[model samples]
Target: MMESTSLYLSPTIFFPNYQNMLNSFKIYMYTPPNPLSFSSPTESLFFSSLRTSPFVTQNPEEAHLFFVPFSSNLSTRSIARFVRDLKLDFPYWNRTLGADHFYASCAGLGYESDRSLVELKKNSVQISCFPAPEGKFVPHKDITLPPLERVTHASHAPGNRTARYLGFARYNGVKESNLLNELRNDSDFLIESQPSDGMTLVGRLGSSGFCLFEYGADISGIGEALRFGCVPVVITDRPMQDLPLIDVIRWQKIAVFVGSSGGVKEVKRALDRTCKDDECEGLRRLGVAASQHFVWNEMPQPYDSFHMLMYQLWLRRHSIRYARREFV
Candidate 1:
């Protein structure tokens, strides 16, 4: 008789939009819209506990394993950041790190609309981590955008229209803009300063740090305004899919995503579009479904508990463990 051997599984191919894919998963787990609390015991477990059987005395191994795993070592917020960032490695991780395994991370509530998560879930293959209290720094570094400054050049200006884009970066697909020219021409369009006297905010911002830009509003503040029923507008060269908004916010409804070519006119166009769209009116009709689905409130969701289940699944399916190994 000959002995048989099996090869360990290879890693999954990485995708550029891996984060987007994961966002979809997070959206799914968050769907049907339920309130989440970072402090909830069931939410933290990510898996149902094995209860004692009537006659069986043996401890159940099933409860010890799950498809997604939560962290005992990190808080829900930290874990949430970890998963959001790890999306870049999805393809590689999916195949080799282990099979049929997932991790549920968590992050602070009130960062963005959880409803956005639901939208993503309906379309992608990723998952959201656990939930946490609102207001904390994400585990990953903030995406840097050009700082707003008074333009001295002639090309950076436009008449009465300020050209503003947040989180602009060449690598991330933002086109190089002539800020000076835009400012010079748009004298009527002032770059809204961070402490704007009366301007409205438009996007999510990183927590616990001095803001990167000098004017207008931070991303978080923008999301806050949206929650309060104020429509927000964001300018970017890349897709808003990665931002705190996206599927949940509805492009022309409640918010706007401005592309590089879209200038002040674009903002107005977005605003105009938002006012006419009737799709979102039904959001109010969903009742608690609309309110709870994918919307994060003061409380966090069951992200961590879900991640723990993933971790357990990885261990059992692949004979691996999380965070117990080290190299000297």
Candidate 2:
């Protein structure tokens, strides 16, 4: 776990504003009737964090934002039901039509039921693991959250740059990528057809200069590769896939991005070009630093995954609405 006092861990630009966010931003968390709604391990941690967070306000009138405690697997019907209950039981939902409300969803915004919840989905911001622009996500309005897995491995410092493999890539699910197939012959790349059920690739990942992780429903691989200091080479057509802290991080400095249109040769070419560059070392060094954001701690750190997500929420702080007339 990263210590909150580490001045050197976070990116230089994260400061001042990071401090500002902690100082002024206030979020009011609604106690949903279903306390069991926060399902995942990460979601449970986040919910617990909010309960003890200094940012949480007892008074909704003073809050800059509101939180829906449920995590992922949220359907429009379920959310609609929850909001309907809120509208009936409280004044906040009806006041601004939930414009200031938000919730986290690990399952991307592609749920068919999402379309059915017209009034609520339109106004409420979704901090989703999957942010497909074609789906429910409204660009800049919603945030792309990387799956926040609890990392137990000690943080490895980036030092020597003597990785044996040029790159590493894998074929996920049933269909093998044409790009991966071409690279299997290349000794420089460790291309595997096996499913990533475990961290079998971690050993190779430590020695690889770049990890070309194709974006899929299972996005955990991206974070796993990043944890070991491998520069992530994300291949995806989705506009904002595999991105967190999109507004702040200069991700181009830390990873290689090849579009879905790019072939294995193109991927190899990009890796080859990056491998030769002097900046590649810097990117590798930054990859170690950037990986810190994917980690979660029992105690929240300064710019850890928790703080970073909070910062994103702070950036997307919607219009403040104090509905209760007497309180206003």
Candidate 3:
């Protein structure tokens, strides 16, 4: 429902170089999702590397999309709290996750699948992001952002801070080899094997086998590594997990389980039990199966031709999906 304040368009609209123009597309980011908190940098760097194709529109109303502010869930007074604690900011955000606001403009097209876009029993889209062409943002090569420095110390130590698990939320049990080497070099801690390259699972073992809670993937992955599997020797909180594909799997089963407050000895003991148990193998197999859901090539970006098609489809329906553009 928010309106745009800018009446002018950028010169990129008329530029001959499609890539330059696409990169110049002015996007109004409302609340940026925390790159440190997310499972991987895919969401953060994905858009920055986008290069618009010839088919994509350049107008602010068409090319520029506004991310819904992460403020809808909190009170106006708590806006600062949400922004500070969650590391989110909605300086010029135009859309929200609300279906009503995006039904007409195609602004919310990438959001979770709904009746307005498609008919699905349950909301198929959990998270929404920009779409782009392949090789638009190559990991390690084009990724230039500095590592997050805020999550260095836990309130409690599990004996080692050098080792970690990586994965997006829910999709668990993946680890990278480089991470293990980083942790092994640390003299302060004993070496532990990291999981395969992905998110590790964490959960409570009960009569039903595993009762997983809604914890972040990063936390769960580390717990899983310490508690059960070790695909790596050292642990570093590196960008490991990408956005997940399937929705059925519980994150706890694949993640490494850890307590919020516990001594290193306790963590060691739990790891001993998990490493020696037969259940861990079954969990590992499940994790391998679950991993098939994510295909890195499928992520969206600003350059992909598919994005343009989706926009045109939405436009035909005659909807108000976007807000006007502004630079500041």
For all predicted structures, in order, the TM-scores are 0.32, 0.82, 0.29
Q: Using lDDT, rank the candidates from best to worst.
A: 2, 3, 1
Q: List residue ranges in candidate 3 displaced over 4 A.
A: 1-41, 44-97, 100-247, 275-277, 298-328
Of candidates 2 and 1, the better by TM-score:
2
- What is the per-residue lDDT of model 2 for residues 163-276, given as tens digits with 9 covering 90 to 100? 898888766556776766767778988877553544455566777888887766345556666767778888776555336777667677778877766677777677778877
lDDT of 1 by residue, 10-72 (tens): 113222233322332211111111233333333343223211111111322322212323343
Instruction: Report, for every candidate in turn, its global Cα lDDT versus the true structure.
Output: 0.29, 0.69, 0.29
Q: Identify the candidate with maximal TM-score.
A: 2
In model 3, what is the error at residue 70, expressed in angstroms?
13
TM-score of 3: 0.29
Candidate 2, superposed: residue stretches over 4 Å from native = 1-13, 71-75, 108-116, 130-134, 149-151, 193-201, 260-262, 318-328
lDDT of 3 by residue, 1-328 (tens): 1112111122233123334443443433333333222233433332332323333343435534432233223332343343333223322222422211111110122222222222110111212322211222222111111111122222221332222332112223454333333333534333333323322222111111222222322232323332322221112233333222111234444534544233344434544565565755555544433333221223444423233223322222222344434433
